[model samples]
Target chain A: MDTIIQTVTSITWQQIVMMVIGGVLMYLGIKKNYEPTLLVPMGLGAILVNFPMTGVLTQTINGQKTEGVLDVLFNAGITTELFPLLIFIGIGAMIDFGPLLSNPFMLLFGAAAQFGIFFVVIVALLFGFNINEAASIGIIGAADGPTSIFVSNQLAPNLLGPIAIAAYSYMALVPIIQPMAIKLVTTKKERRIRMEYQAESVSKQTRILFPIIITIIAGLVAPVSLPLVGFLMFGNLLRECGVLDRLSNTAQNELVNIVSILLGLTISVKLTAGSFLKVQTLMIIAFGLVAFIMDSIGGVLFAKFLNLFRKTKINPMIGAAGISAFPMSSRVIQQMAQAEDKQNFVLMYAVGANVSGQIGSVIAGGLLLGFFS
Target chain B: MSAALTQGFELMLFGMGGVFAVLFLIYLVCIALNRIFSGKPKE
Candidate 1:
């Protein structure tokens, strides 16, 4: 009777708190439909990992110490960089760079958006985070989960959960965060400025050559980025080659789904209450917000600067697309534009810049890894 | 503290330089490709 009472009391407040947090994640997934694929599994994994006295973490078989199944999957997939790379392949296949190809200047917006990463890296270091940890945290600004994972794995694997959670959360909240940032930085006149959309149809030759050329150039320039850049370009090649429709379809759907499940649950293994409920995690979240805001500012400021020399003025609102939330950021920009003037503009240019942001963010991650390495 | 600041400054400079180099290369490649493939306005 005493042993049973002891067992009942052994389950602590912290574990109970973690369970509640897990339940919240589940509610968010099932009810709100916010990133359901990831949040659902992650919520389950969090509950499994936080259960106390389970001996799941310490269990051994045949006199040999072995990690629990989920922990093993986590370390093998995430720590080894398998999950992020596979996800990148799918992202590459899903992307159509036609819009960016038409508007080459969009690349500038992409590059500009990365200002948040560098700026926050410095700020984080001042806050006493080591260089490696700072790099990992700063990548949350990329508004990309895989890039954040890849960079954190290379630079600071321990911070993976916070970084990944922050990246995805901020990405989901982009619609809210970006408008305020845009409104703060750009006057209504600038938001109302309409740019002409040139309809440039790229040829098949250009489409096929792009992935190959970018792969070779980027791989040569930043050898450290080869695996990521190479695989991403390969996926794009599979897409553009027009010979592997089945493979492209698989990459976009089946392959991405499997990898996302593994990645989601594996990432949650780190959400054990002790590591996650901390001052460091809180600071990382705060700085992640800073990085995102700075990215918006950087992209918008760059666009404003360019307006000085150009006959054609760009809608500064489109600069928000530079944060690489992809179509979401572009959609937000379009809505904001429409809010000001019903027929003000279309979303194509913002979409182009958003795609450019994807490439730019990946390249920046590679460059950071190379510089630090 | 100063030493850390110096290192931070170097990293910042390197990061900025990389951004510039990358931006220039992307712009140049895009423009060059456009010029090469402009091709009689795609009738």
Candidate 2:
């Protein structure tokens, strides 16, 4: 009873703050539908870790250090970089590269949109973070949570919790963040620009070959990203091959769902108040928002630049889809297009650009790894 | 600019440039692959 009393009283204001944060995350996830699968577990885990004397975290028992459940999971999963890579496989399997295959030019928009990652690196540096931390913070612009986790885990492990939070929170907010950024750079006439959509007629042979060739190219270009790029493309191969439909289904469903639960909760181990309650965390979150906005601006401006040479005009709104929140960013672009003109349909192009953003994001992450790590 | 910020500018230059260069290569390769498989629009 005395020990329990001590434990209750030992809780600090910072712990209360973290618990409040955890509650807010849970509320945002449950009520607001903000990436609930990931955020819910993360929120619960944050609450679990913040209590003064929890067995979920590493503790000294009988003067001997005993690893807690979260620590063991973190070591085996996040430290070894297993969880993010596994999630990547699921992401790859779920992505239908059909639209991207129909319009390979969308790949350019995807690459162009990664401008935020680099741009934000400088901004983070100006804010007094070191190069590695800046890079980790900047990867929030990738808008690919797994890649953000993967990059930050290696580059700035200490900043992992904030980076992960910022990455995911901003990703869930893409619909709100992107439009304001897009509208800033694009005129209403540019928003209503339309392009013809071709039916996806990519052959099964091309489908099978696409993943394999892209992996090989990634290997040649950025061998360091081979593990990340290779696993993702392997999952795509499993999907496209049509021979391993069962495996692909398992990857997309059970494997992904289970891994997401573990990944979300495991990262929260870093969210203990001691590490997380800091001035820098708020700055990181702000930087992530800036990164996201810049990504939208970059893609939109690139489209406007390309429009200089084209006979047929391309919708600049589709360029904002290149920031890689997947179908969500693309959907926002489509909705905005409809808002501008009811008859205009840019869903196909937006989807193609959004899908390309996935590949471009990984490639951009690979490039950063090449530069920094 | 501080040395770190200077390095960052270089990063923006090369990083953005690297993404474009590699993706452009991928674009060329993808076009090549499409021609071999689909055969309609001239590359």
TM-score of each: 0.94, 0.97
For candidate 2, write residues A65-172 as lDDT tens digits. Answer: 867899999999999999999999998999998888888999999998998898899999998999889999999999999999999999999999999998999999
Q: Give stretches of model 2 more than 4 Å off.
A: B39-43
Question: In order, what lDDT does every prediction score?
Answer: 0.83, 0.90
Best by DockQ: 2
List, residue by residue over A311-367, the lDDT tens digit for candidate 1.
888888777798778889999999999999888775989998899888888888888
Runs with alpha carbons beyond 4 Å of true place in candidate 1 = A1-8, A55-66, B39-43
Clashing pairs in 1: none
DockQ, candidate no. 1: 0.48
Interface root-mean-square deviation, each candidate: 2.0, 3.1
* Candidate 2 docking class: medium
TM-score of chain B of each: 0.80, 0.79
Q: For candidate 2, give the lDDT of residue A73.
A: 97
